[model samples]
Target: MRRTKPYFYRLLQLSIPAAMLVLAACSTTPEQTGLEPAQADEPETGLVTIVKPFPENSFHDLLVAEFAIRRQQYDLALQLYMKQAKQTGDLGVIATAARLSQFVNNEAAALQSTAHWLTLKPDAAEAHFIRATALARSRRPLEALQHMEAVIGSDQESNFATLAASALAQSEMDQQAFETAIRDLLERHPDNLNLKTGVALTLQYRNQEEEALRLIREVLTADPSNMHALLIETRVLQQLGRINEAIDRLRFAVDEYPYHKRLRLNLAQLLTRSDIFQAKAQYTVLHNQHPEDDAIRLALALVNREIGDYESAKELLRDLLARSDQRDNAHYFLGRIAEQEEAWDAAMDHYRQVSGGDQLIAALTRLAVLRSEQDGLPQARADLAAARLRFPDQDIQIYLIESDLLFEHRLYKEGFALLSGALKRHPDNTNVLYARSLFSERQKNVALMEQDLRQILSNDPDNATALNALGYSLAILTDRLNEAQTLVSKALKLRPDDPAIQDSYGWIAFRLGDLEVAENYLSRAFSQSKDHEIAAHLGEVLWRLGRREQAISVWQQGLNNKPSSTIIEETLQRLQVNLPDSE
Candidate 1:
């Protein structure tokens, strides 16, 4: 009367005996046979046919489910498994359903399956853990915490701190809520070192450094050999900007735990940042101990490169390139080494192998330079165009590099045209504007130069390079002495130790007839940089002050440094001093 047609239809669909379905629905425990408890009292009715009908549709569904699993259709498999779990009341099927649901990221179905599993096996730690994880991800922290407590109580394999930390890490709660929850747990489990560590980690994540450090120290005090506590302490020290202290702590920890690779690796990395020699020593020992470890070998090679031991670095990189994992990086470093040695062919070969990562652009730029050196400007320009086509997002950098090549070769018109075209595409780009201004200076287009530099200043008032360039141009070529003085002074204040700015200040003083001031500034600039232009300026100042011998000595040194310095030659000829013969 209550509609047995749906039940008949389901039984037909499942192809199971009606009596077996009834037995499955009524079974209370996994060991229950086909007989329901109510039926067991009176049923010796000898219903062998009821027990014998094969679940053909369910068996076929299971086969289809396995096929789906083999094909990596986990979602469809999860649905079939969950249906089987509900029909059979089988613990194994329910657990599989829950696990498969989790695998497919079907949180709602996972929670449902895990809830049923827990109902069947109330004391199952794995079921509690799965439910807790699902609940936490679903943002039901309170329910998750209850199940987490049960998991901690039942699971003796992992400590309370570790489980709690794992839960906290996976929670979506905000910092304050996380801290509050963790603190509450800590109050309940005060002696749980793992839980304490978990709380400290949460605090650290929130940047509550002082509290985190205190808790980590407390844990270390209780268990001095605790590697986790020590690592946390080192991290806290680093966050406080006490890198040296962090290094010392790691060094001591490594000595105590001599075989602990992580501790030693941390010490080595910190040493690399502060003292390369010490880093190299540590890495050498590590490399000797772990000859099969490519990371250790790579670290040693990089340290060698940093210390200018290019031969050793090249040998290490060559050995590493024999393996496939670090081929690109090895090629990049090899290219750099070859470039240092001025072996253009060798450098290009290595750079061409470097096809990806952070060094790709740098390698390409170096390759272009080498091509220009070996072939010609036209080849370099063509290569740069190809590079731009290959890496369209890096158009700005390619344009800058090509323009720099032209400028260095004294092809002013070509450089200007390239920069003008780039500006048309990227009109507000500061680098292009700055480069164009420099090209205008070479062309002696003072108005264009001033306009470009002022445009830069309008956007970024503190651009020291533009300020110095503008000021120096006005001091040398125009009568805006006071304005030039102000601009150069501002630039000097912004970059107090810049030698170029010092030279500009000196040049301004010389133009204003302050010979002593000019000499002092020029001497400072020349002493700091040893630049040919600074040397020329100093010599001119000295010659004007009747110190002709000193001026000649300075000019000679400048000529030795830069054999073809036009500024030094012109100053010597203008002052009626004899120019030295070419060396």
Candidate 2:
């Protein structure tokens, strides 16, 4: 009744404790898990002692609970422990139940057990933290804050901050309530700098960025050297789209605290978007300071590669190769460098050495692509077949790559056949189905395209990609405007921030004769991505609204973004709109 399904999923996110194996060892004492058995009843006969079992906290219950735990039946174990806690009023049992409940995300159970725990040990910070977690999860943020305050009073401020972070990820209403509760607490602790920062954090989560910035400035005013406040101010400034201000703040912070690793790392990452040279300089300092840090070294290597300093990148990558954990990544990047310099043999050698890790598939794909160009398509296909046999887990991805290669060579029939075979081997695989659907569209097989997209929707009704695809296809290629509108509307609700889905929604609105709504949605989608198709749709809407000059300007901008966009060209042709050639 309390939606235990989501809690079960949350439980699965955690690694199962290795201690559960001890349940089967017979050496584990009942006190360890707090499901202690009742003492055996003995008859008064001096010669022979006959043992009797009691119903409450019986030995039988202990064995069953331990067996359940060994079998990974955590819910059963939790139930047994909860029952024992209630019957015996053992603090240990209550504590175990509380922790287990929280682990499994059973908010109600956690609250009840933590209440019992608090009753026995009123000063336990763990109990307050656990209770606060359950209360926050249950949308009782005010009550949760009280327990969080109690946790802080017990010098568990770190734990309270962790709870607050988790609370921020809750629903919008919950986030508002959490922010409001933090503000109320800040009122009580007016001079508490941590409280001020906490309010600023919650306000940022609630999207009150201006207010959050003001609060952080207040903290900075009180303590100019507050690193935490400085970090929060940078984040708030970034959220408010004032990246330069954020960069300046970080620059000042790094100047003030040159030894701060996080401050410099943040500065380096921020600079990567706007000023690559500045980013490289910051990363250089970070790398020099932390020579043993592989992540910093990798970042510096990437920065070097981006700046065309191939020799420096190669040196850093070679250094990373000494660490077994980073070997595959190192080989992958080295291969990329070789490819960039047109050293095909060296690139292939490096890629071949990437035997495992996250880069394995990428290396294999690149190796096959290069092989196809240098050797024949037959040899490349054979190599892909060998890769499938060697890495069966990557067979589907390998097949997709093969199809891409075939399509790139204009072998449409071969590519379609490859995807069809893949679909036979992996029926109802959404990725394969989606790929096949795109191919079907290219072949003008509208029915097949609809079928594949519909199959994806049937398997996963909330799949926004399939929804938008099917809806847009209907709007463009069929006379099903109403159906297209409905599908696209659902997708927009599911992924409101997705530019592709927004474009689909606008396209459907245009077909359904809602010009103003279409304009608004298309403008928003284009503003987010400047994507060619969205630009085409938006320009047409503007043209229809009798704003021909505005329409041409939008079209020109789209062309500047992507000169090879056939969609924009076709739209212009269809509308008989002639544009002057760019100077």
Candidate 3:
């Protein structure tokens, strides 16, 4: 079978003649005439022949048109190509004009040029494809489908199923009508599996998941090794939230076709989310089979990291970093590893090398956090400011990072001013408002704190952070014990496993004089986090209950962990309890 050129390639072929003509014109020389010395007495020929410039030849026009295309002047190129096509009656030229017109969004010109192209070469599949695409662009789906059908009918190897699928994918027709049209087409070719798959995909797009699944299952039953059917079935199951079922199905498929690399890869990737040990085993096998594949190596590294094999993960990531393609991802993951290990310097270096991708913002935030922990607020602020300048779109996150650092250092005025400026720029930003409220609490501006938290709650009534913060503040700083309990209880219900909210609930219970309840919640919170503030609160509750020895032990542990914790210092001072001096 003689293969036909793709639609775009046929259009590109039109430029060849124009390019040749340009070269020919450049190479052509005018006839050289011998000049004779004019006699002085000869009558002066004063007639200045103002030769009106010869109308540009077709070759010159073609040169200018090709140059226009190179300069992205598609409109001008389309005009020139259409004029040349009309003059030359070349089907390739007409197709080029049609495609360029479509490229520039000149629908009318595209239709006219496609008509000329069809007239020139009625059997050309590329011409039909161009006409179909133009019709699709003009929102004439039925006509476009007809032209696409003509294209497929003209070529035995035209991939009719893919063409139909692409047309249906791009169609703007009403869903039921689109499905009806596709079903009608499918009825004509009921035995064509590819067309059946296309219809199933269309059904899936229309949210008819049950029908889509039935068709895909039928396809898979007919040919159990059909990769496309298997992939679609997996996707449908995932959408239905039957992820474990999908994993099991993929695992079965992998067992059936152990040599199928894609099946193995899919099974491995799916396992990464649910069963890290199994995922690690699958990736290790793939790595052994394809040692040079960077993607497989990266996958192995990720699974290793998830399974707590940090040393193996570090080695694989370092090897990937040695290669250029996966360097950014390797650096990002290495930074994560270092951050987890508290290797602040190494983490900062790795994060600094991450220049792009989805990890860029996360890397910058980690850098700010590490700097704040190691060097203090000033350096962290400088690093975050530089990151902001580098990534202007992440202003909201940068503001939060700086404000968090300021708040952690007890620089209340600085934190408040920063959030105030950020709020002025983005007045209704929930995060900025939430952050400013925290600073307000620290500054003892209780009314402002309540106002800011209430504003956040108005926007998002179920904001657990605001609920817990307001509740904890009122419990410790005011006599609204019942209201505090209500808010903290709501927060705990929303986020039962969150240590911070648990601490808030514990503190509220202590204020309500429920020592046993306070002891239970605070003990759970401390067990989860061991945070110094939670420790301080727990020790205070224990001391109030006359468990003086236990309170001293908790405070000593907290002091060992965070020697300068303000809450611990204040609790010891107010309770008049002193740790025994160790010689």
Candidate 4:
């Protein structure tokens, strides 16, 4: 364990509860907010005081709480902070408590606590912002919107207002309200770069993304070094799927501001959505900058795991643990890498150290998958129960993950029953709809699969994967070659040059009995992906076109990549077909 994995941590997937923005109000006293020390530290004020004047705070317990949080131990950290909050009546403590509460899916608790703080200090902008966060987490976007507006109004000049507006603009579901609030702010501060970024963001949220791009471009034209503008442009590029260009732009920006930790981190994240080489390159820079940054180091480990450098990643994480600020994170990440690498015993070793909602939810998910993978369904279920006990709010994901584990284990009836039951209850969930489509596809229930896919497509027209899935399934299942071609073309328009789309196009051509075009498209797709099914289609096309030796070689390569693919057997049968040898 040499400890230096040139990796970055996963960007904070801060649920509504875990966010510091939501917890900001309670993290400091009025004194901490630059108020009079004696007044702010008074333990008997109408408003709560998070940190007393006592020296006890800079002691071991707060450090322990911080350590637990860094290690992703939300439950234990929450317990510690919640106890402190109740005892101290400190808004800062309460805010920290609220932040931890989100990981547990305890939105009701967070709302109550944050709302109480708002009541105590009605004019406190940060308090209102925290309340907004709680409301947003609770899915009360309307209420969140009101409070977000309150936050902006309360602190008309503070950067806090901009940050609050950003959160509100990003999360509010109603396009009109989101846009109007942002427009109002921009009207007030037209030349404010931050507000302009906010307007661009709101425009993007309203799906006028190109307009948002133009706004950012206008800003960047004036100040190319505008970090916020560059960041927004990078995101727009990614959403547009110009991944290469996004990486290129971000890389240039990073070079221009090499010391900006946030810039390098953002670039690394952008790369994760790009090709493996690009992702690795961007991550390497961030990793080198923050050799001690556990987040970056963890990301490097995941990348290593993804690229089959399991031993190296594991060693890096192990070395990192001794030096990591949060030992639990080092262990958890190492465990995750181990789990993916099929080092089950080592994974469990890491998972055992985790107990809070973050760690438990993660551990439970992985252990269930592992147990199910190893013929231990009952144990997997027990792990999931433990997860629910620790983090009760994640009913949907926990159930879906369990069902998926079962499906992967070939327990189709159990998995389908679970998904079907959920669909009956929450029929409008896009994810559930997508999952049901996948289940149908796996069963080779062609009619049902197409029906669900079309349903999903109707609701989410730009669903690239769904479009590709339906197009490919149609090509493989039926002789409606022209329809398959159109569907695939639409998918390609949505996700240009996507490997899966190319594969679908090739497969459709093969189904139409056009061996030459099939060979060309299939060859392109093969270059993009080592997917077995895509290879089988191309191999068969090659064989039919009298390239038997190439077909055999392709099939062999595909089998090496994905031995479980049934299509490999079918491709071998192509050799038995009465096809003439190439001239």
State how far residue 368 of model 3 sits from its true place (Å): 1.8
Where is model 1 more than 4 Å wrong at Cα? 1-253, 259-278, 288-296, 305-312, 319-326, 340-342, 523-528, 542-564, 576-583
List TM-score per model, in order.
0.57, 0.69, 0.57, 0.51
Candidate that scores best on lDDT: 2
Candidate 2 matches the true fold with a TM-score of 0.69
Supply the global lDDT for candidate 1.
0.75
Better of 1 and 4 by TM-score: 1
Candidate 2 residue pairs in backbone clash: none
On TM-score, the candidate that comes out on top is: 2
Candidate 3, run of 10 with poorest lDDT: 29-38
- Model 4, residue 456: displacement in angstroms? 2.2
Alpha-carbon lDDT, every model: 0.75, 0.78, 0.74, 0.65
Of 1 and 2, the candidate ranking higher by lDDT: 2
Candidate 4 on 1-583: residue-level lDDT in tens?
A: 0000000122112222333333333346532322111112322223333433423542344456656766877677767766666666666656556645644656676676667666667776665655665666654544565565565544333232243344444434464665676677667656665556667865665567788898878778887777877887877877787778877887787777887888888877766765655667767777888887777877777777678787867776787677636566667777887766678988876876665535555666676767766757887777776665666676567766776676567676666677787678677666666666666666777887788778878898887777777877776667766887888888888877777788788778777777788788889888888778777888888878888778777777777798776667755664564224323
When sorted by TM-score, best at the front, the candidate numbers are 2, 3, 1, 4
TM-score between model 3 and native: 0.57
lDDT, candidate 1, 44-93, per-residue tens: 22222223222566555555665676577767777887897787666655
State how far residue 230 of model 3 sits from its true place (Å).
Answer: 2.5
Higher-scoring candidate on lDDT, 2 or 4: 2
